[model samples]
Target: MRSSGDTRSNSLRNIGLIVRREYKNRVTQRSYIITTILFVLFSLVASCVPTVIQFFAARSNSQSHITIVNNAGTTADLSGDRLLQYFNSNLNGSTSNGAQIPGQQASQSKGTPHFALRVDTSTPISQLQKDVKDGKLDVLLVLDRTANKDVRFTYYTASASLSDTDLTQIQTTAGQLSVLDKSSRLGLSPTQTQNLLAPPVFNVVYTQKGSGNDSLISLAGGYFLGVIGTVLIFMAVYLYGMWVAGGVADEKGNRIMEILVNAATPFQLLWGKIIGIGAAGLTQMVCLVGAGIIGLLLQGPLSAVLQTGGTLFNLSYIHTSTTLLLLLLVYFILGFLLYSTLFAALGALVKRQDEVQNAVGPLTALCMVGYMASFIGGSVAPGATWFKIMSFVPFWTPTMMMMRVATNTVSSWEIALSIGILLVSIVICAWISARIYRIGILMYGQKPGLRQIVRLLRQ
Candidate 1:
């Protein structure tokens, strides 16, 4: 009365039960919980660390004191004096009590010397060295105009850790002074020379219409999303790939897989493990995403205090189309399943723990190749026929298609075509992996290649 179909169905149900048990065992384990918590904490800290640093940087900038020893010649109507004055004036709108001249009246209640420009004309060299050594000077600028055609500046800072922006501004000012001096000497008017010396005016050009909303911010946003997604995909692979491989190896090593095979076929057990580990990966990803959202929300005020002109935290880049997100979710799940199943089968072929890497070498290489190609495809040859063709291929499709979608370069038809090809490839890969699993899971003391696998599949 018992049919083969009914028996197969019952066997599948048994495999499902096994899968559920494995999923629950892993998900509820203390190690998994601790790892998930630590991962979330690390991601939160990493995300907010930049903002925290920027806040401290801004506060330090406001509170910072700069002692400027201008060793340039005096009554050479030293342009250094005018440059220092301009710097002090510019600092006014930036902080509470800004930069002040050496002899200027103190305006603030604290009387903290924000900055002081000391024009030292006494031998300039030894005086500068003494000032630097005495901690009386933070920076020493020697403006020389002796027999030289142009003004030359030699700067010295006592501390090795001087701010780059501050140094750049100092250099820019000196360069400006040098250019202006040269132009004045050559009889070119200040206004004409200033006009000529000013930076060129340029506008960004784009060939795509209706993509006017595309800005550096959005492009940067897309790149950020692409990087995060790719990294997450790789992380997921690392986490669950090892899980699949290790689980298979553990069962095989312990001779537990042999006993399980008496009750259910290897295909059933293989898929069960894949599903179980996939569930565990999803559970961890949920925790990570939740922590990220919480961190983004809570860290906003702290972020805005540090950055200029725009929001410190933004999730608008996550506002991708529903269809694309759905497709991505599907592809991610399928891709994980495809790779993890193969990882399990390959792992079953190995006897020792150390042999796992060697057994899975081809798969790892494939992943690396796909990842690298996907990265380069959109960046280097977005319009290339080969790149477009490869985007529809399942191996590289997840990263390539996702990037193209982010860059708004992928069309609806292309997405449809890629999805179709990916689904078909997934089916074929799953079948191949299932065949290998059936032969490999119970196999012991022997490693197999494509030839052995092909012979096993035929059998």
Candidate 2:
């Protein structure tokens, strides 16, 4: 006694209910709970790792001391006084230990430069090396400058890639000397040379109408945001697609799909599985991202300790914006839906899970191409014509568009156009997938080839 309208509404309601059940069932499972908890724990650990490192670093730094032997008097052109004063100035406001005299109480001289400097022009190279090897000196810098060329700065390290900051300081100081020497030959005084080298003299006048401030930093921020967004989208899509394929295969192998099909159409069943698995993937990501944020906030103490302790470590770099994050979440959900449908349809065509590896190869390759292209295109040519156009193609578009948004200010229209293209592509893909689902779900035994799928579509 129900009208067609009522029947349609009820059907839609059922689908919504199924989606809720799918999401809830996934979110409430023991595996889901465990996975989410592990993700959060991993994230926190990742974040706290730096802080932990820093704490140990500070402890080690308090116990350790080093000596600098500047025999070449290479730092003399900058300061005629002992090279240690220059070293102290460079290291001060930077290192934990203050300037250490041989018999000074370490506590009273805390934050004073700790390293002892022996400016012996007569120390034999052999003894200097011995001092370094004996741990009397942590590192040795033999700065031998040619009167008219690059300074022959030999840094003797028991380690490789001299702590980058220390290397940077050495390089900067050497570079300044080089410039001063060149300027002296050019008939300029030391003061004049310093004046010319004063930080690049140009003001960036940002002229955007509505945005508050358009610093290059903000542009860099956008670029970083875009990169993160692209990465997250790529990860979500890639992970969830596998989930869909695997979920379908799992149920099919267990013969649960047969039972589910008796109660619902292939489309409904496929959608439910996609929603369930997709929710699981997102939950995992959220936990990980939250942990990463907490980790970044605690990096300061850790970084300081590393600097003072002279340890080598690379910091994790992560950045994203609220808008970009929301966009990524939306894209992930929508992209997951689109890809899950395709994977489910493909799954239906295959009887065994082993066949999925071959079946999903093309799809996986396509995803990899898109993911790599996003990274490559970002660095490959910056604003290349091909990259810009590819940013509009659905497969490549999400990542490329994100790159554009992050590295530069892309127009709203450009973003809108790319989104529209993706939406249309998704609709078409979904339709095709739904058709494949209907035809392939009941299939058993022999697997259908691409040719058979094409012909079936024609039918």
Q: Which candidate should be chosen as best, given TM-score against the real structure?
A: 1
As for candidate 1, its clashing pairs are: none
Q: Which RMSD does model 1 reach against the true structure?
A: 5.9
* TM-score for each of the candidates: 0.75, 0.74
**Could you tell me which residue pairs clash in candidate 2?**
47-295, 97-112, 98-111, 98-112, 98-113, 99-112, 99-113, 222-406, 223-406, 223-407
Q: Write the per-residue lDDT of candidate 2 for residues 65-162, one digit (tens) a residue.
A: 33444433433244334444555443442322222221222232334353444445577867878877776666676766565554466666454543
Task: Give all candidates' CA lDDT scores.
Answer: 0.69, 0.65
Clashes of 2: 10
After the best TM-score superposition of candidate 1, give how far the Cα of residue 411 lies from its true spot, in angstroms: 2.2
Cα shift from native, residue 269, model 1 (Å) = 2.2
